[model samples]
Target chain A: MKRKTDVAGEAQSEGGLAFHPLDQFQVQPLFGHGPIEWYTITNVTLWLALAAVAIIFVFVVGSSARKMIPTRLQSVGEVAYSFVHNMVEDVAGHDGAKYFPLIMTLFVFILFANMLGLLPGSFTPTTHIAVTAVLGFGVFLFVTLLGLYKHGLHFLGLFWMSDAPLVLRPIIAVIEVISYFVRPVSHSIRLAGNIMAGHAVMKVFAAFAPMILISGIGVLVTPVSILAITAIYALEVLVAFIQAYVFTILTCVYLKDALHPGH
Target chain B: MTTTTTTTEAAAEVAHETAKAGMPQLDFSTFPNQIFWLVVTLLVIYFVLSRIALPRIGGVLAQRAGAITSDLSAAEELKQKAIAAEKAYNDALVKARAEAAKIVAEAKTGIQQDLAVATAKADAEIAAKSAESEKAISEIRAGAVEAVKEVAQNTAKELVAALGGSDDAKAVAAAVSARLKG
Candidate 1:
């Protein structure tokens, strides 16, 4: 970090373009400055709570009316409800539908967190691997345990494709087993990487937004950078929703494997 | 949000005293905090959703679907009733038209019967009056013929007296009768 700061300072001296794109991702204390303990109420806590509140706003208050003829707010709740509902049913199949609330929690929580993080100067909980790993591995652990409990040793048949030639079956099983274990890692990283990259790039552009204050060349750089920022922000909104959706659907896919490992 | 300045100087100094640190996500010092809060958030979200929100929203959706279905059936029933009413109205209209035609036919038959009787009575009266007129004409002819006969007989007698012959009324009458007969 010190080296990064020195490099940024040198860039500032050279072209007046000092910016820390990754700085936005730093977890900080929301209230007071100190060493962060396990129970410390940091920005992650505040934002996580905000995400929960947003979930409540969309799920609880949005559906508080329960109107037969739904108002706009109720429609929002219903849309989110049906969207996740259909995704679960579609990907996880009928037997996996009982786990809908679990999937909904993940989708809504991640969705709200990602969206709120898009606000300027706000922290994104999902951008942290620690947070996403909890989500990804939570699904992973649940699915593995459920599979092992339900099918016992038969669950291992998921990796052993019997239809393959005897010569290739062992090789295929090894690959399948390894890939199966890698699901949570890829799942968590895919989301965090997409969000972090988009945000970091936006920060990079935003850092250039003040170029007009520095040099005459900023007349060109400032508007272009602002446009880039706008474009990336728009894309981030889409990415935020898509990542949540991706996470939820992947959870469903994994849930399907747990329920019926034969496929 | 705290920048790298505060993050690098203190948090990293306390937890991870690595000579070189790169990304904040990689900073293991904050992992415990993030993991702790994430667990809490997920737990809260899961409980709230499963207990309250999911069931409530699901119930409302199911209820709305039920309402729409029932409303459709009711609309279909009402349409069926409207169709039945129109059919009934058409049937009544047909019956009324038939009744009116029957009444018009009955009134026409009654008027025709009366006209037939009146025409027959007028014909009979005219026949009777014409027979009476014919009888009067026949009587006048008969009387005129008798008067002409008498006048002829009186002239015959006068003609005979002028010829200085005797007046034989019976012979003259007989001769006139014979001449008339011939």
Candidate 2:
């Protein structure tokens, strides 16, 4: 008794967005009553929200009872803190400590979000270009403003080194400017692409889990697939931390360049 | 040319209609969407983490690292103490062994002195006993020789007195005695 079009699969989802292979990255608009049109919220927002909440909870509870003798949770918090602190110091030096709050927050939030997304039914916020771009642009702007504020017109030296010879200055400047503009694109794409690809692979593998579970040969594959899943899960966890670390470290490097721009 | 233009126009119109029908009006091109989310994220990160959560975590982490470092330093100090004690023990053992050898040498020297004194005393006693025995034997032989000479002298005197009444008897006695003695 179904409709003729439904049987033929001619119809689509009510949203009208096609079910493309990578539809998860597309932005959908949200409608509201007011003049201020609400942007449609996606699973990415929820993932980030959950990550922030978890980070807040862990830190808050961990240090609630400030004691001379710390608990295991406190030690974990300390290790995370020192790790980011040392990284900042190593990349950005003493001045980098000023941005510790930002860097650490970014690292922990992204890490938690990435790891959380690996969970079944969870969405990875970084998988979306919008989220990654925003983060990348924030860093970009912050570094740019910081550079201008710190060195004024001298910031142009980042593009064309004043110390370079006149003959090669033009070529070097062109290359430097292109590289500079490409930073945010690469940064954003690196995170988004990695997350999206990993998730897609996981999803594809997971889809086969059911089909393989039915056939007799499927039984043999169950253990292998399970092991692969487990290993992939662990790798995702590592990737989460590494990507976050890479992002933070890159930010630190940018901040360093901003603080002292030249060659 | 006119037919081609007309056909192109019709095709464009149909394509537009199909596109309008197929896709929803998703405003992904707008800047407000990105800006709004960015601001929200910034506010969330700044306030929630910086104001509330970060401080707590920072404090906890600081305390934990401090405790760890202190413990490590304390362990290092203890290890140094242990090493120093071991060195001191070894030194004392070496000193004790040297002291023991010195004591043994001193005892050996004292024993050697005692042995020398004992040997000297025994040698002197033996020489004294030998000299005393030689004196005793010489005295005993002198006494025996003196007694034999006295007995021979007495027998000759008695034989001379008993056998000889004249010169002829003296000569015959002399001859008999010589023959018997010989």
Candidate 3:
């Protein structure tokens, strides 16, 4: 109770009346007051480490028993494994199974990070464009390199849709090339944008929670804000899982393009 | 009011400084650290999954599949045994019924044979009794014929004596005997 009042006082002292909802996304050095150096450990690092540890706990330690009948935690691990496994296989075909581990790693990492962010005061590493951009660019680079290696110069054929009119072939090829390069941008933005928007909205609704102290209309607005927060929180949970799925399946789709570079 | 305004100005400066820091995600300074950790964490997870977790989980799944297949095969074997047992039971039952019918038929024939022998023996005894009764009846008829001859001879002699005719014993005997013979 004392901590709550102190935090409220701090917020008031810091111009709480003009609270910026996006302030929650600010990254700062976890240690002594100083500019964040490249080597400085931040909240992003802490939460990301926690997310990785959570994934390892569920997958590695939970399945250490390797029981023929899975425990609850092991079942969760297996479901995640099979879910990504099927995605890679179904979308990218048997050739995609080879990359299942890579795709699975991305999925578990992002999934845990997203879900962990739902905890109050926890940082969401996935909401950052930097992290998502890394993943997207990594996938883009991997697929592009794989396609080039496998098909050599023939890989360029993917850009040319032979079904189109020969007169329009060059134009279509240009469009395809542009879209192809745009994959990483859209991929990173989609996940980071969705996660950031959901978190920001939640924070906005939470900011209105202080309206309850306004006396006259506080009582009515308080419940409505609380309900909105609850609703958005629920939606964010769905968004977290959906964004992870969307990212993984899209990776598989790009892998398919690499594997089969034809129309 | 002046002190309050100064405090407000100070707060605005702080807020401005915070805003100047901008979105941490956009902060170019933090990228290397976040990316570094991301690579490190991803590499760690990848190693764990690829080296340890996935293979173990896959082994469990494979073992489960093997167990199911073995169980199904065992069930199939047991079903075959059951079918064979049922067939053997049916065969034994048929054999038992046939044996019972054979025994019944044999028993019936033996009884009929004994009955025929008894009937034949009874018929032989009846035939013998009728033969002896007929012989005795013939003997009694012969005796009655001899008595009747003797009487008839006596009557003849009396008749003769009353009429006052010769009454010689040897003549009378000879005449009587010759008339009887005739």
Candidate 4:
């Protein structure tokens, strides 16, 4: 109880624990204290750098040998390559295979970012709306442009339901257009939200882990919280992988819609 | 939500020092910075993958597929060759068996011809020897009959002298011959 009151000021308005769960999401300069300028190298930059290095190590250096029989890292690279490749080819259609590099870029970046963020004390780039919104909106714009370029004015036919009765056609088109615009928002939020929720829940449970040292309830609360933290952390690793996969597959689906924009 | 607690600049500063982390995600001030870094990261990743990584991997994958396909076709070719070789061997074997049978038949006919000639020659030799033996027996019988006639004449002369009756050799022989014939 003494420790609780002593450190409660650190947790601020959150009375129970000495730490805030959302604090992990904060952006700060990597070198020292400074305002987070657009050009400043921050923790986000550091982790992003780490993600880049990881991609290079696995994809670039790993497959450098290009052996008929692949090494472990090469095998891993090939599996990831083909997984995204097949996904694009399957979902985005045969013509969509041309965009393999773009889809692959998104998938690899998001995947690496998500996986790296699982390290202790690490910042999750995907957890931020700015980051995901960029990805989501990026896909949205790319798909829209692709549709417009390929189908021209007919691309607008995506929202037009010719099958619907003439009276309800405009209403349905309005609904479709709204849904179409919402793709980026939902696409970005889904990844960011899933990752944020899991991490926050883990932080909350982790804060309770010190209960054993502070209160009589420490005996039970502390162990349970620790166990909960472990379980959630494991779940977070899964969420990390799943979120990356979800974001990529959705990109492919949107690409498919762009390529063959009919009914 | 927690940022609402900051009623003054001092409180916000204190919050920064303390748990003011608030919804750091919602802190609009960091948006530009985050977006900037995120763009740089994405662009870096995009280039690294598209230019360096993806092509290398895709090439390796395509190369591997090509190798596997070629290997399979080679195996199929080898299998076909093996099948053809086996057929040739069987054909040769069948031809050799037929040739062996033909040689055996030719040898059997030659042996039969030789055997028939030998059998005919042996039968002719046996017939010639039988004719010669019959001629010799006839000659020996004629000589014995002459000796018996001479003995009968001598014996008839001795008996006539001893009995003081007849002494003619010709008459004795004629009478002995007539009795033997009867």
Candidate 5:
């Protein structure tokens, strides 16, 4: 078993008073205490499964009736449906609507997972680079494959911009190809970093709350810490939804490029 | 100083272990599990959304659009019918007015013909009465002339007898006839 010396060092540095803010992100085996195997059901697995179940309940069970005059639950289902639908169609054009189901699934899963992480003691799967990398790379692979299948070798034209001057054309194409390859890295990191930062900041502020009882001047610091936690917590809620939206729209934009690869 | 060095070594050992257990997200060991579960979850969600939820919602939207389109077409048909009915009504009114004028003209001509026939019959009756009255007046004048002749003969015979002269009936007759002829 690995010893958590950094947590101990952090405790000693803070005079053995505060908990480590990043400890919440640690993945642990949910069952037997052992090293996490590939098949071991960790907290990440549990929370991701729960997010999937929540999505099913909201989209499947909520919309099962398919009422014309929608019930509240049905309205929620319809709103999410149209939101992703319009995004896919508008960004990707009419042909892009064919991939609505995939885009909708991605959006709802990330959205629910991010929101569930805000609950006390819940694991956020989106905070893991592994999970986000799969999603980002999945989109990257799917779009690239689709473009190749649809356009054949001509799909490489997406990297070649003819609008620029002849001398700058090759230079611009190199940059475009690099950026295209870097999309999955940036895409995964953006979501994971934003979520990890927000949660970490909140934990840091929460660590300051106990200082009020520990020191003479803690009274002044406690209110400020509490206020900061409250403010950042609110911001995290917005970030959670925004990050999901950003990921889904980027997927659509990538899909548009695949369908119509040009300058 | 020896004690401080030992304490520092102990802290370093603890920090090393802690670093090993650091951010689980960066830990390579858990990546496989996270990726596995993520794939499973995404596949399941995609299946539900594509096969179940999306189709149901799409059906409702299509039904709504169809309902609206049918209603609009029905309304358009009714509007055309109303316009046709209004045109028919206007056409009937114009035809009725023309028929009424024709009847009035026919009535006036019939009345004029009847008046002309009545005036002609009244003029014919007046002419016949005037002719009959003229014949009667001529008959009366002839009878008076004959009576005057006979009386003149008788008076001449009486005057001749009174003067002691023979009266000749045939001569008086012949003389009277000659005087009337002249």
Candidate 6:
């Protein structure tokens, strides 16, 4: 006795459409089997790949032409190289040279992936929570292992309230542990959610233009949609670069804490 | 009639309620499924690109930079050689001009000496000719006087011989010789 739309289509929530635009983030299992769960092929993946190739190509080619009198290409490459190199040195300290390769790689990969998602018809891989989570988890795992290896069980001092008053130690320790556990989740979700929300909203707004134009009821709607898309797109571009920087910088900070759990 | 109207109204209300109910719910779980595969795909890409493709590209870039530096150095050497050659050529040109000026000055000195000798010889010849002309004029006058004396003596001798008087001719010749000596 259900109507046609009810039987085959998405059920409209009393709140609105059954699928809030954000509902796309819900992680549903594909076949309900295997260690390798399936997810939708969103545009995020496409962007990440684009970003990776672009960054690699630009920097590699730019630096490849090493001249005593450097060309514009070489300068740009050196700037990126020096920036990341300095970041590692500052956070990881003088001994950070060892981690240069890893930090540099992370910066480049994240930056390129983020930028790649900005292009039309492309997906950003970093926009997926799974992908970001894996990356964050890897960093966490690496730094934690490094800390434990270097300091033995004393690395646990990173999470303990060692310097706090005796009475307040337990309370601070609980907070510290919880914060430590939230590291990967926050790192991954912060990036993926920000990018996904921006793109989804942009897509929804874009969908409105055609609807308004075809309906022919309002002239202002089309222009408004266009302006909104432009503004959001611009913002997304900034977000892409910032997020990459933040991710790499945070990784450096985590490494610093692992290497020296002083504070 | 009133009951019938009420029954129709009730049926209409039921239809409106069904219409307002909208569509059924979708299995909202599909999104996570999509995200999971996306991770796998991304991982595979990262491994293949980072491990394989990126290294090759990096190698090419390194080679290209080396090539550029070498080319620049080679060009610099060539430029230096050209500058050296230019300097050498200018020096040679200056030296050649100096040598040429020296030869011209030497030739001028030789010509001046020849001119001085020729002028002196011409002046000496001119003086000698003027002296010789003066001697020729003097000799012509003396020869004229001697011829006149001889003529006179021959006539006097012819008259004396005709008269048979050799003493008269000797006296006349002695008088003429004394006058010529004086």
Could you give candidate 6's per-residue lDDT for residues A75-159 as a string of tens digits? 6666666687789889877776577667767777777766766776565666666567777898899888999998898888887
Q: What are the lDDT scores of the predictions, listed in order?
A: 0.90, 0.72, 0.87, 0.89, 0.89, 0.69
Cα lDDT tens digits for candidate 5, A1-263: 13455566767786546777778998889998898888889898899889988988888898888777788988888888889999999999999999999999899999999999999889899998999999999999999999999999999999888788999989999999999999989998999999999999999899888887888668898899999999998999999999999999999999999999975
Candidate 2's DockQ: 0.16
| Candidate 3 local Cα displacement, residue B92, angstroms | 2.3
List, residue by residue over A150-188, the lDDT tens digit for candidate 3.
999888999989899999999999999999999999999
Worst 10 residues of 2 chain B by lDDT: B19-28
Comparing 3 and 5 on lDDT, the stronger one: 5
lDDT of 1 by residue, B29-98 (tens): 8999999999999999999999989999999999999999999999999999999999999999999999
Q: For model 4, how does the per-residue alpha-carbon lDDT over A152-243 read when each residue is reduced to its tens digit?
A: 99999999998989999999999999999999999999999999999999898888888777668889998899899889888888889898
Order the candidates by TM-score, highest first — what do you get? 1, 4, 3, 5, 2, 6
DockQ class, candidate 1: acceptable
DockQ by candidate, in order: 0.47, 0.16, 0.34, 0.44, 0.36, 0.07
Give every collision pair in model 1. none
Grade the docking of candidate 4.
acceptable
Worst 10 residues of 6 chain A by lDDT: A11-20
Q: Relative to the unseen true structure, what is the C-alpha lDDT of residue A91 in candidate 2, on a scale of 0 to 100?
A: 85
**Model 4 spans > 4 angstroms off:** A1-19, A165-168, A215-223, B1-21, B130-182
Q: On lDDT, who's better, 1 or 2?
A: 1
Interface RMSD of 5: 2.5
Clashes of each: 0, 1, 0, 0, 4, 28
Compare candidates 3 and 4 on DockQ and give the better one.
Answer: 4
Extract clashing residue pairs from model 2. A78-B61
